[model samples]
Target: MKKKTVKQSLAVLMVSFMAMTPFQQTAHGKSTVEINADAAILVEADTGKIVYSEHEDKALGIASMTKMMTEYLVLEAIEKGKITWDQTYKVSDKVYQLANAPGLSNVPLRADEEYTVRELYDAMVIKSGNGAAIALSEVVAGSEGEFVKMMNAKAKELGFEHYQFVNSSGLSNYDMLGMYPEGTDVNDENVVSAEDMATLAYYLIHDYPEVLETSSLTSKVFRPGTSEELVMKNTNGLLKGKSYHYKGADGLKTGTTPFAGSTFTGTAKRNGIRYITVILDAKDKYGQPSSAERFIQARELLNYGFDEFKTVTYDLDSIEKKKKHTLPVPNGKEQEVTIKVDKPLSIRLTDEEKDKVKTTLNLDEEKVNEDGSLQAPIEKGEKIGELVIDTNEKEEYIFDRKSSDYKVDVYAAESVKKASWIVRSARGIQDFFVNLF
Candidate 1:
């Protein structure tokens, strides 16, 4: 009997371990990180370098992930003095009905009651309160219709692609209890690509930064010390004390729906390097929608980013050329001139790729002589060429990798004047005689 009990316990543990990993991998070899989702992406926050991606450009249901755009606009309005944290928003009949709507995530709000912007912001973001989102939108744009316009306009301005917002909230129009913003179809839901969602998250963190203070919170009290008071727990399961509870995870957002499945936009920082990961429509082993698979994929995705990759500095001080780079200064006081690179730069790379990196010196055309030597009368700080660092990686960057990302401009440190005719003539004559001998 005891032996049977022990066997049962071992079976349970093994099942749990295999359940966390939903995809296949190579046997008896180094583990390859793969995500179980319809669309997924991992990007380095500092460099915008794409670490891993699968069908990142495919547009899918975004679910509540649409609120991220709302968060961005709220922060922008505050920065521009259009709104204040202390400002109050009075709930109306529209918000009242939705706040009381069943089978939806919301904080109960009383009609005609005023709630501060700070409170509603927390309710909407931390609790995914549908009614609070509409109230805040009304406060920002005077109506949900105008706010929907603001949401779409902001997406365009931020360079978001494969994205369309029918309402300020990520909730499907049908879920809005027939009160969805005007001019939007009642059957429509917000749609965005995995890469587009990452773009919005990047701008939110880089532009506002303060959103983390609320997003990272595992729980908050909505309308505390009152009859309507309730504790709003963050939907992001990757947060501390949440289901996944990954270390270094502070803030982000998560969403789930019948059509969208489960989607999560997660971010975490370790050793000064932060990574943002998006999992869209994650599923279980049977490829069915799941509530836990999204967070499971998020944990693995963050693990791949923080474990397999690292940030290293590629500076000019350490590189050695085969020979000292020298440029001839014809008819100048000095026969030759030498210039050096300015400084070092930081780059993101995997541990294995560190040894694969190399440096190249490219001389700008027309800036130097045919033989790669500088002519006389070279001015100080003159442009010569660039020092470029190249990394041989199989994956491409998420954005158009800029030359400025890996190349630094080189310039002459000092000026050199032309030599006198007598001196030039003497040198020319001396060279001719030497060659004759």
Candidate 2:
């Protein structure tokens, strides 16, 4: 072949570089997202699929959003019979002083008066009442310190990698007027990653959806029809009748502090889909946005989720291929057993991801023999493996405790009892002869 001129070679190289760029970027590029915060994320509630994220890894002050953990523990205690909604608590000196402390968000409480668990919880969730949270922590754990320990444990069990708890109320230690939980610094504040906060919100709503019944209320009378009647409006401005109300807006929490700046964990459902969004350190070109500005940031994120992505569902039968496959079963009445997902699989995705998603079967290794065959006596409907959904996009998930794969467990389609002894011996002899050959 004749050598090409320098200019001709350069032209070919440029064309080749352009041709390779698209494929390289498709393989290696991260999907970039923009949100009005230091860290933010949007995830589908049911599946925990990360639709978009921006600097979601840093652990920062969460302000009153820390109450979600307290809320979870309270609900769990109620569910476990450790506490009752009507159970009453006398306001301790620390909690009473904190409740009446100037500038703190709280429902007015007098030291002499007793309150019910139900009323305190209402104040905490609906109004982001700091002292109410402290009182409830005392009710659930016998002390605020013990409740903090429970919060940390629950966070770990929920798959949180970055989080810290100094108090049940999420107020900075200094804000607690020397009443912060024992062994914590006066400057300490509850800190958590955006992803972790979203995870907390996910479990809160899923584990006890009844929370929304109160969280969704735009305003409630703290002690309606009584002398202490005071209407408490939800801090989550995105709720209906609030400053930045968005359609489908409901339960969740909002927060602000000098350290956390502004943060919000917001959830809303529409068209049979719900999205959980987290905004940490809400900001803009002008700098730290107002406390309520976090809702605006959340609205933008929820809008992107509700608009850009769509839910795609696939029942086992609807899968075009490989919906069911047979696995070998040795010494059984049947030679093989068919397996499939127990129910439909659903995931949220953008148009691009929808086209790129693929399905795969993963057999449980523990149940398979060395030769990849199952032993006889397989039970019908036994969990055998998982039906996983894969996609090319870089994805984050809230349920890291579960496998990264969005999957449903597969089960055996039918029972396979052991074959007769004579039949097994004959099959073993046939297998020996076949292998020798």
Candidate 3:
């Protein structure tokens, strides 16, 4: 009986060890890093394809990384002519108080001191200054509270359905999800999910590259009036030196909190390849040096994408570029007449598969109305038929395997007589009504 018990214990230990070994290989061979964080994600910025992910959709406190949205809004303000770099804002008492408040990052601007929007932005991003964040929020939205509403609204606008906001500065003392009583409906600031961070990062880079320039700065001088001449250093150590040896790793935000752990939205560009990596709640047992872990993961993801996946440009120049035609009906008068694409066009494919993919025309009979006959004369480039590609493969991948059939719209060459004017007008009205809903 004792031997049986010992054998069972040994078996359990072996199973556990076996389970851990694969994860170890994943960490080592794949160059993936595991942190104490709640979630992390790595994506190829060019393709928008996720390369690595773990609990990516799980929401958690985003900490100061909320400033990414802050940066976006500020840029929007600038673009709308509501503000400019040269515009100077008087330092308010609220801004002064927040600046001097204990435990908050600040440049400690005097109430009388003024800074340009550009300077304030530099302070906000370079120092991760809570006071700077609040001041910018107020200057943009009249108050931190109003600015937070903008933040939440922007999250919704960006399709970040998994997020909510309660403060301009992510300094709330409660879980963003309100899991505790301290996490009241208001006053409890929060955000969650590394996927949202990745989404935000993508927009900031693709939609607003100007904001990316600020995060890449390692240090900056805020004001020259001070005795020491206010110098600020970037909180994101990954941007510090060439020692990390990551090319195009520049411009992003980082965050940390007791409840949130560590969070970051980092972007790197190499050659034409760009990638964004978001890590949330990253920490070690001793609670230091997690940045290196994230860097390793990001480097690995970028290398894998660039090395493993080759971008193939299917030379469409060889295929006869056909012309599209318009039908000569009422509104369908010969706008254009075009031939079908007889080949599957692709950007990424091996030499062999690229040769065999052939395009075929699919001209299905027009859909009949209540009378069981075709609708009125078709217009040029109208959706009359389709072009299908045949790859000769049983299974098809969207990009390389086979191109899905596309509708062919060859317009009628003849125009309707004047007697059909009333019918065409009725059809136009019907179309307008149908689209109104």
Candidate 4:
């Protein structure tokens, strides 16, 4: 004879319809910050969600901002125990030549001088020193060529499709020392989209948070206690006391070249919320200084992210806490087992969307047996269903077509084992006697 089974119908909860309201202008209306950048983006640091973007995928030269990759590699080396902050590295003749070269931002280094890895890192980050970048690259990878390979490999590993690095620093092939064979017309400049840059910044900060301690420095000495105490000032203008000083602006890198125009990757914290902004190929226009415009654009983007969006956190634990839904177990020692959500969810939304946000839970019935009852011997962590949450927000942008829907797997909270016929009979008799009392 076939064993008996139970079947359950799908449950649907109709959340509020207010979530379907069309997007409307806020009290301040749309942002008036004229983003003069060829490509720019603002992202929440924690969630890595794009808050505001304009031409974010446009490819452009990143200039000195390329050093961010170099910084990442050095930090990685430190983390892997290949190098240490207190360890020292000697300056090579090539590094010396580049440092003394005319018109390049650099902290002067001498062939006879040995500097700590920490000091050189400070120079590279604080001053955008091409020489310091090369010195650190050589120390980490034995040669700048090898370092560039590692950089590209890392970019690929990080899911970058359109970024290329020709040098550890963001210098052009011709400008870099031996970047290309003599007299080659190869345009070997670092190229990346604003989106990729933002992604890179996100990982760099996420993995090595200590980098912010260095990037946020407004000014420092490159060779303190030495005769050649070169003063290194932060290239990012949004730092405190700068011309475009923003209130909460902290660390990040800046870049500019004739070909790349001006670029900046800035991060700031306000009221415990952090934002990262990227501006590439920002040009001087409308009576604004060319180099200064990137900072202004970055400031505006960061501010927009903070002001326009608020975080919404959903506690999945509450689902199990408030009410425990049990699944009927067929031919088991226990008649039912509880279920729970696998993980929590969070999202950022504008005030308008937040006020209208709605969620609904739906269980997938296809997993049910023919009789709608789960089989006994069910594992504690088995995925029995999924919870579907619909915020009712729609993306009208040409780039994104999917609705604001999130799904998380629901799992069995406890195990259930099959019971023998004798055990079931004894349990039924015991229950009858207890109820008679």
The backbone clash count of each candidate, in order, is: 1, 0, 26, 5
Give the whole-model CA lDDT for all candidates, comma-separated: 0.79, 0.80, 0.61, 0.74
Choose 1 or 2, whichever is better by TM-score: 1
Worst 10 residues of 4 by lDDT: 1-10
Q: Which ten residues in a row have the lowest lDDT in candidate 3?
A: 1-10
Ranking by TM-score: 1, 2, 4, 3
- After TM-score superposition, the amount by which residue 364's alpha carbon in candidate 2 deviates from its true location, in angstroms, is 9.0
RMSD list, candidates in order: 9.5, 11.4, 12.4, 11.6
Top-down lDDT ranking: 2, 1, 4, 3
Which of candidates 3 and 4 is the stronger one according to lDDT? 4
Displacement of the residue 353 alpha carbon in candidate 2, Å = 1.7
Off by over 4 Å in 2: 1-32, 315-342, 360-388, 401-437
Q: Which 10 consecutive positions of candidate 2 have the poorest summed lDDT?
A: 19-28
Query: Candidate 1 has which clashing residue pairs, if any?
Result: 315-344
lDDT of 4 by residue, 1-437 (tens): 00112211111111112212222222224445557666777777876666666655555778899999999999999999999988888988888888878888888888868988998899999999888898998889888878888998998787664566778778777775554423233555677777778878988889999999989889997677879887888978999989999988887888888766678999998887888899876655542226888888788777777777776665444344455578788567888888877666666677677666555545556657766677778888988876665656643221223544767777889889889989878888988999999
Q: Write the per-residue lDDT of candidate 1 for residues 235-272, one digit (tens) a residue.
A: 88888888788999987888888867788999998888
For each candidate in turn, the TM-score is 0.83, 0.77, 0.65, 0.77
The candidate that wins on lDDT is 2
User: Model 2 Cα displacement at 427 (Å)?
Assistant: 19
lDDT per residue for candidate 2 within 1-437, as digits (tens), equals 00111222212211111111111111113344445566778888987877776555667778999999999999999999999999999999989999999999999888968999999999999988988999999999988998999999998788786678889998989988888898687867788878888888899889999999989998889888899899998888898888898999887998888877778999999998999999887775466445765787788778887887777876455445565678899889998998766778877767777888777766788988878788888999999877778766665566643344578888999999989999999999999999999
lDDT of 3 at 7: 16
Task: Return the lDDT, model 1, position 17.
Answer: 26
